[model samples]
Target: MSWTGRFLSFARDERVILVSIGLATFGLVSTMITALTMIRDDNEIPPAEPKTQYITQDTEDSLQLDTLEKLLDHPNFSIKEIAVKILCDRAANDPEVITYIWFGITRPDYEERMDSLRTLAVLTSQTGNEGLARLHDEKAYSALVRCMELCMQSTELPVVTDIHWDEYYLRDMGERFCLMFLTELINKYGATMLVKAKFVEKWLAKQAWGNTPEERRRNFKDYMDYRNNRITDIVNRIKHSRRGLRALEKAGLIDKESSRRRIRELPDLLMEVEEEIAAGEQSGEQQSRRTREHSAEEQRLRRQHREAMVLNDGTRPLGREDIIERDASPA
Candidate 1:
């Protein structure tokens, strides 16, 4: 199957979202600002002694492409740094390399994704290759944006028959992958991600709660109705099981059946029914508040990033020196 086919299967699932649109878009923005943007002002980044020696020769393509990609997640920082440098020089422009990088990151492994981000962060600070970095940035961001667009265009909303609606999956993606991994670099170094924070704000505001709370509530109501129907079907099946069993006995001497299936599934179905009942229906006011809270959170994140400049660095983030100092600072 193609990447598109595999991607859709994940997207349609209620418990999983593969390289989700929101998260991927957020990741692209994160890389664009922090990883791709070069700091030019010397004042923002004071000179520091280079801890690692520069490579005299262009050993960029020296390592086999497959081997170099593996080094991105190597246990040692020095090895990972070298791999980042090598890839930034040559492999950064290669489509296969970019795809390989994305494929690695899209997995469910947290440590693996962070290691990838760490490599990108290193590439952002490495000097003497502005044009190459830009090339990489453009290609990577464009492909990610395209992927996000494809997800949005997908008509694969769960049928809710074989599957049930669950907001938890999106929450998982936001917290685990998008919020945690993407923000790891900025938070660790105390660097301000002003653009990234803003991007997050805008993206969140585009959610159901922000733009059309009433419409969203109506949609949820429809979903609730569907849930109710499913619950009813299960309840009827459980209550009428004995009658069906009798009818089967009359039809034939009745083959054996697992009485446990009905018993075991009953508790979960009942729980879902009770939860749905308690949830009742969403109100316009509640939806509006959610939207406001998201907007407020965006403000808070922006301010936090803005103030982080002073705390993370002596000055606002601008040049490569700031990163070097942050690296040199004792953990």
Candidate 2:
């Protein structure tokens, strides 16, 4: 008989077949019951945990963090808002990312710098002591001072004004909260909180004017002077000048070793110095002309003596003692 017919016959007519079928059914039912029991027991199987990924350069899934680092360079307003969201959500804990964000605040694009500063203030407020303590260094305060200045707070308060928070009304609470916190800090401690440490204090002194538009424009000019070989490299040549070097050393914003390395990388350090010298020369020339105008009589006598000497055919006095006396006479 075929295998199928034989199996059917065995199952239908044999006691052995019936016994085997009953056992097979029992085993299958028992296995299902065991599985259910195990599932119901909390400790029977180890629990599975949801996976979490931290922010990093390689993180492709986090669009906000990725875009925030590049927000200062982007022209789109919506993209910047999305970037702010991502930064507030994920990159707050990452120092490098935070530093990159600070760069945007320090050297921003369009309103991106302003937007980034608002986000930073919000994060600072939310993180409280934990975040503040971590950022107690000079660089953090310097950046904060600049941000506050940009917001028009003379005291460099952490609290942001309506001008900063409500201007665009991007509808993001995170941005508003940041502005509020910053404004509050400024309102509470004024600019002192911004210049807490001695190093930061020194940086504040040097960059005191840096927050102002005019001062920043001047700084840009100074930077250009340095770049065009007008003045000394403020970072390098100033190393020996008491005010310059001391300020540089006390500037916690710069990593000393790193700054030194960067200074070494640069080709010249006295571009601004040259500019200053040139400016001085021009001023000196102007002053000299003004002096000659004020002493016209004396200048005329001196000029006459010079002309007479030149016309003397390389020898002899112009008109003897009278000419000499007139030339020597004070106006």
Candidate 3:
């Protein structure tokens, strides 16, 4: 039989085959219609897995530890991104994760590391764990500082969500984290790191708690007054010892009547020292050239003077007694 006649004979006895084909076709058409409907629907999402945030003490502790450990293995960008998403979604407090994140900043692979740092910044601010004060690396410390500076400048009320209703809670946490970070820097590195890092002074003088210009402008006068008051408080704290003031000066983070002259101004202070060194080198070279020139001039003048003396000897007459004695003795 021909192939077509054989195929027709094969299906002619199979009513089940026709039903199955029809059903398969219907299924495909239904799937296509459903897909089109989904595409047209703006709000359709594969219903998100219900997120469970930790509220109790133990769960939070566990989550934090888990995230902290996860940080060590997350050298890959994709893994770290996934880990942060998980941590932020759960809104779990993990002190270990917080430290790990800060520690991550010191890692060489930290070019892709900002996500974890930003996550820690948000977490520490949310949980109010003062342990964030333990972070000491200058760069990590600065990133947290910058994040807090930004958070404080946000004028918008906290977003009300099914999760968080109190804006101030997060704000307070952020403020605490920032203060803790600064306080830790002051306590451990004694603010000298901040000054040497050139971050503390810049942020203190111009930027608001957040680095935004508008916020700084809005809060500048108030910050100035507050800084004055803060200085007074610092002075009182260090009232007993010259060492305290010296430490502040060394850090270059403080500016006041006593500490003002002590704290080095950023660009000018460093530049002036460099310029002085350069000038000294240049001066030394010039001095050496001048010294060689002066020596040559002195030698030339001496030669001229000696020649003049010789010429004078040749031009002038001897004493009359000497000449007479010489001529008499010779005769």
Task: Give the best candidate by TM-score.
Answer: 3
lDDT of 1: 0.40
| RMSD, every candidate, angstroms | 36.5, 25.7, 30.8
Candidate 2 residues 172-248, lDDT tens each? 33333334544444332222233232323333234333565555445433443434221122223333222333344
TM-score (C-alpha, index-matched) for candidate 3: 0.27
- Show where candidate 2 strays beyond 4 Å: 1-90, 108-110, 150-193, 196-331
TM-score per prediction, in order, is 0.25, 0.25, 0.27
Off by over 4 Å in 3: 1-134, 156-173, 207-331
Q: Which candidate leads the pack in lDDT?
A: 2
Tally clashes: model 2: 27
Residue-level lDDT tens digits of model 3 in 178-274: 4545654453333433443433343344322334544443343333344433322323333222344454444332435545443221112222333
Evaluated at residue 220, the lDDT of candidate 1 is 36
TM accuracy, model 2: 0.25
Worst 10 residues of 3 by lDDT: 322-331
lDDT of 3 at 140: 57
Q: In order, what lDDT does every prediction score?
A: 0.40, 0.45, 0.44
**TM-score of predicted structure 1:** 0.25
Model 2 lDDT-worst window of ten: 317-326
